[model samples]
Target: MSNETEPAPAAHGQPTLKAIADAVGVHVSTVSRALKRDPESPDASKSVRRIHRIAEQMGYRPNLMAAGLRTNRSYTIGVVMPRLTDVVIAQTCEAIEEAATAAGYQILLATPPDEVNAQLQSIQMLASRRIDGLIVSSIHLDRPDMVEEILRAGIPTIAVNRRADGKLHAVTTDDYHGGYLAGEHLVNLGHRRIGIVAGPRHASTAWDRTQGCIEAITSRGIEVDEELIVHTDFEVQGGISGAHRLLNLADPPTAIFAVNDTAAIGVAGAVRDRGLSIPRDISLVGYNDIPLVSQLPVPFTTISSPAAPMGSVALQQLLRGINEGEMSSLKLPVSLIVRASTTVPRQN
Candidate 1:
């Protein structure tokens, strides 16, 4: 017999197949097969059950990277999400991560600028890592080149938050309906002259919301003042600039509907600078009832989009596409939240 002493497994390190096999008095191949088999299966062999018990005691975890090399499946998901600094985006990504983890997959995330070139680079990098699937959140409505490249890659893909001009499966909020709700609320409050802090037109989310708001206003026999609509970035500064432009108009609107809560905060600042107050000089409505909006001193009247659910549903759709060669688009519903920031327009 050889005189070599058995090596002890590390206390804080991952347990290897050899370690588990040795503990179970079996060969490494047997241990590998046992690990691959479902431990909870009612028909598992007695030997398999014993191996699993010992493996559990040793805290063994399969080497997915190593197995992927042989199986040709990385079992990893790639995510290209921009504006992660935004609360809504952050919440959505967190949900995606949670869902991916629960589904026995890991995510390789890239948070590049929302520009097409930058996003393309990120996608390329993720592809190099052999991602099994992809989720994109910043697809521009006016640009289809990057989306075409993604489709050509033949990897299962899903879009979230924004659609790819209907070129890809998407999980998004009903932004149009959300905008309509905001406009309808303001109009019901007797504010006929309304202004819109529309976001960039490149994003379908912004354009759809703008169109929906306009539809609500015009459907009520109110002529929308084209001059009242200001398209800008989706940031607070954009909101501030748009608000100033609308307020400077010859006939300023009595109500302002900002496409996002962050922008609405900026609009509020502009109102304060103009020595005006919300619902007094201008009734303010915003989309996306982020947690901070509800805590604001003048709580925002906003549309509550399902950010977390969108992420979760996107993951499910991508998995279906990856496994069953099936995919479909989804649009989660949104609701309007009445808060202190909105009320009947002040009597002139």
Candidate 2:
């Protein structure tokens, strides 16, 4: 009404698809097809690149939620872990999240403290959020009740880090072979009296590693004394207690194998507390070579489970189940990493 220059129609701060189309000299449909990466669009590849470049320059971000309304999908996956405090799971989940974002999906994370009932509640809650699939990074061993809940919910799921008994899909390391490698390494170092710090007795990891170690030891005509093996939580305190007990035995072991890195660190602490030195008094080996293990004062010899590849493969399986009704269990290989922590025993 006044001489105020008509306000320039109040510059729209948010860029829209139409703005991108007009800027790139294309129709809105062509802009959309370019944004969606639809190959069949009449828009040429160079035009698509130009549209994308302009969209970025204009600060245009796609509304995934709004697109989801038309697509009937949340384009989100739920990732479940026992605890993010655990380095192995945290790093692997980082890889999964990165890969998922690159593949145009979002991730919702949950940690239920490794309790089956709590996990069931978590699954139900994530399902209510309409997550497209779930990646359970930790599973309680042999919990049929939990497995039943997951199946009944009708959600696509892939187990990571651990696996079920062919009941559901999983992507995990070759734990059996990993344990065998640890055993063969120690046994080949001329260690006969070996102690085991096996993680939770009920878990498949503990069972399979135990069996594989036993097999490898026996293959060399060495009898594994049942009294030398101990099952405990995969924590520092648990490993300390187990290691202390083994060291106090009538025929103390010359080498100890812990099924987890945390426990292995604890065993190392136990050795030092007793005024003993590694490789001279005792040798130690760990599984799942978490980064911190290598940085320890006495770096642990360990099995390098492919954490990144495991996460990638798990997501791949989940996507396949979501898109093609196909999911299969997968086992990736692991290799042993030798370091200062393991060597030939003094007596040998």
Candidate 3:
């Protein structure tokens, strides 16, 4: 017997569309069109959005895969990720799954673990399963050819949380602005000498952030010593080693900005291992204010992105591409959350 339970089986007591309808006092069919996002009924869209909120709260997904198979049109979409160990990715998927189920679609997930060959294999696997569309969360910044190959496969595809050279539609945050916000915060606190833990060379998230930080410093008529920058993987150990490199510089920075919250955790460790105190000895800033960040000893001062909404919108655009052959890129806004982790640098 296959341990794999079929999609949307209510046998496990998972909330169904009928559950949403009952909760919201609306009909199940009305909820259906609302999930599709372009409801013909004026009253239907409002009710659907409400039901969507309720379903998301209840952790409901219809598991409509069996129905798709029966109709000869698998209302299933494939999602490719680098990995889901990151809390940010996990939360974003929650939003995606809820939105997809509301729109009468099912999700098929795959992970490539950041290897190009594995990514292509996953894509092919999803294709073989006859997914109606694809939403890729990880894009190798260097590989244009891989994108072309996916496009050539004749599937409606969209990139989420990542981007390439405008060769494909991408739904992402205003990463540049996120970076600028961090830089501005640090600079406003009177830290001229700063270091950045940048991500991969090709990743727009890292590149834009690094660039935004530079722009912010330059705007204040300060020069960023290129020596303070270190490009590395978006991980905690990368933060530790990257911070080490910056702190060892002839003129170390009083402030550091990490690419993400996980890296910030490592950056904080590096500071302490070297006998430094956060904000007092050195200040820190990070991106993607995941929930766990706020609970830390010194809650991170970070840039916050709408991860779940981004996932929801990504699925909507992908389905649009599949049905209408129309596609466009989207950049959501971000905001900075000031917390205890950042403060004015001590007089040195």
Candidate 4:
């Protein structure tokens, strides 16, 4: 034998359940039950808090990968959004996280490069993670394959703001009512010639909102000039470009309604650039009532999409599906908010 001694094998990292049990002076099974906050366990709340505190002090992290392999569940939900930069999406995501945590689930978020690919990648990643469920908040929902994939994974999936073509459950706002409200508000303000800035044609929300607005206007005997209705991306640049096209018409509309707040802001900027005073020259309305709308130089009249409630409802529905195998779609109501940007048009 050599004089040099072999180094002792490095001590393995402490297992989370074992460390929690040792710190709490309880059996590993009790630690597991306590950490799960099982209702059947006696004094589970107190035991859970005690175990959680000890686990934190010991720098213990649960081996989710190994647990997922064993149980076929990660106790996590996959949340996908078109873009985290969008204020409405970000707020909804925050609410989703809170709701998931309250239900003892963690969230894994994915923002895809584009709306179409985001849906595909998010579903695939979540399936690979063995997630308990998924919540999709992106705008693209025309693909039937997305629904088939989710069903193939054999996990619950809920769509928000976009409805899939198949039997998949969905949670969305009443887009038609939102559009009708916008149209009625403009009509009541004595606007006869109204223009619309709609989102992408493929988005169901855009189609429904446009239909509602057209119906409301036509029912009141107001003519909807086909040329005044423009469909574009739900972004500021789209608003700017659509507004330019509308204003260039032989007889421009007295009021313009944008499908979202970002586009409305763009319309407002474009109108100002042309030295036109809002309501006096052109009235503007927007949807989704994002926080930024209220803080603008002229507060925008908008339809509140109830994003937080939608998120909470979606999570609650997902949990139900996870525990009871129930799946159902839900449509939350929308409310119109009158603000400074809309007014009676001034006669030339």
Candidate 5:
């Protein structure tokens, strides 16, 4: 006897339309047409449903690879963000995922290590995956080639947070308005000399917030001291260093507005290190109203960017583009939350 003991019976291959047609006692061509009946064809719903049920029972999986090769569409969206480590970015990613799932599509997320080169690589990766669309939330907006390549790939692209000067579609908050609100609020509280902790210079949000603050202060006839404005990374240490620079001035500001809450918390710590009580020696306001800001020992007065809403809107726009080639720019609203950290400057 052969050691193999007669090879086990070959497993049955997946059922095809021909096998289903034979079981249903119909022609293979009839089964094929019935399975994919045109809308104009008469009363094909029953047959189509029957075919679908049979296919399901047979554990049929569509050859999506073949279809994608033919149509050059993967029915997937590429989402590029800085990193999920940032709470706001993480929340936005969650919202995007929810929206994409609701629309019967999948999202592929990529975090670019750096602003310039990461954008280029992200675009290439999305293109390679044959993604139907892309939503990019960038730290900087200087990548012309990235946008151009996305356009060349013939995929709809939406920029989030960072806006480009060109005609690309984007979804972002009213950053200037948010900044203006923060400025006006501080000025209303009688904070005459205000300092600003700004994010990186290349980021449009940072520029908008800075300009809005300047405009608000100038409109009130208050001179915005150039030395009071310090550009730093959007991190805790950045805020700490910025606070030091501002407070060390011969005439320190009565209040400070940090670009984001993380930096604002740092400013708060710096103020305390100097044996100063918050809102007594110096009032502080922050942006982004991130969760931890409110839960801190002293709640921060801050502007709230609708991160979740922005993410949802971006996904909705991308889906529209994928389904119907629709495109539009969306600017979401932001609000200011007054908390314990800000108050009228105490007269010495």
Candidate 6:
């Protein structure tokens, strides 16, 4: 007597929507809506509640792959990022995943080495899987090829953390401002001879921060010693090596500014090995006020970048591009968190 046509049994003897609908004496569409309704909503009707209970009893489960075929949308966002082991990168990914879930999308993540060739392969693989969109975090500044590949895929895409060549839309913190703040803070403390643990040249984030710091220093009529700027990886070991080089100079820097907290930790280690104490032998400034830096014996004076928000906003931007066919870049604000690791230079 049911008006709804019965669907075949789901694979492996699993229950289908029609089965739940037949149990509840309603249309399959109604059952589908009931199952998708938010459980926490206060306005769920009695019939919807009854449908959920019946579906549970019938062991009904939705098949996402089947649903994708029916709707022509995978409802999946591909995320290609490097350095998942880094805490800051991990935090950003967590935010992106959380936002994607809330928006009824799943995340397919691929973490390759932060190199252009490796990333290109990862992006191609994700595109082949028919992802609805892509989110990238480790875009290199000099690689137009990567940007071209992303455009060639013809999917809605957005870059987070670092941007590539200004060709792709991105959501990033104001790295330049953050660097300027670090430099200004050091200059205010009467530290003139400053050393920089500038990260790799190919990253926009690194360049922006380094340039901002240079601007702040030069704006105050202090020349940035070309010898004082050392390019290194955004890792602790890179920090240690760079710091040691600066410390061993004929006229070593009285203050060191590391572009990231991880590198700053390395600088700290190197300083300790040299039998020098922070704010006594050399003042230090670091970017990205990561949680661990705040708890250090000499807490880092660093810039607080909005890593999580960058991920969240990047998702929103990608969604807009997908639905509206338009996207715009955004730069979030950053602030300086002064801590115990910095002080005025000692009198020579």
Residue-wise C-alpha lDDT for candidate 6, range 144-208, written one tens digit per residue: 88899889999999999997656899999999999999999999999899999999999888899
Q: Write the per-residue lDDT of candidate 5 for residues 1-348, one digit (tens) a residue.
A: 534222222137667777767655678997766654322223437667666556546654455456567666676889888857777778888999987765446789898764777777887887788788888887465556666766776778888876765567888899998889989999999999999998788787888888888788889999998999999978888999999999999999999999888889889989999898888889999999899989988899999999998888888877667756886888888998999999999897
For model 1, give the 10-residue run with minimal summed lDDT. 2-11
Better candidate by TM-score, 2 or 5: 2
Pairs that clash in candidate 3: 7-63, 8-63
Clash count of each predicted structure: 0, 0, 2, 0, 0, 0
lDDT, candidate 4, residue 316? 80
**What does the lDDT read for residue 125 in candidate 3?**
92
Off by over 4 Å in 3: 1-72
Error of 4 at 47 (Å): 16
**Residue 309 CA error for candidate 2 (Å)?**
2.5
If ranked by TM-score, best first, what sequence of candidates would result?
A: 2, 1, 6, 3, 4, 5
Per-residue lDDT tens digits for candidate 4, residues 154-245, read: 77888887777547788889999999999999999999999999878878788888888888899999889899899988889889988988
Q: Ten residues in a row with the worst lDDT in model 6?
A: 2-11
- How well does each candidate superpose onto the true structure, as a TM-score? 0.84, 0.84, 0.83, 0.80, 0.79, 0.83
Query: RMSD, model 3, all Cα superposed?
Result: 7.6
Candidate 5's C-alpha lDDT?
0.80
lDDT: the better of candidates 2 and 6:
6
RMSD of each: 6.9, 6.9, 7.6, 8.8, 9.7, 6.5
lDDT of 3 by residue, 279-331 (tens): 89899999999998999999999999999989988888887887678878999
Off by over 4 Å in 6: 1-67
Cα lDDT for residue 161, model 3? 87
Q: Candidate 2, which ten residues in sequence have the lowest lDDT sum?
A: 2-11
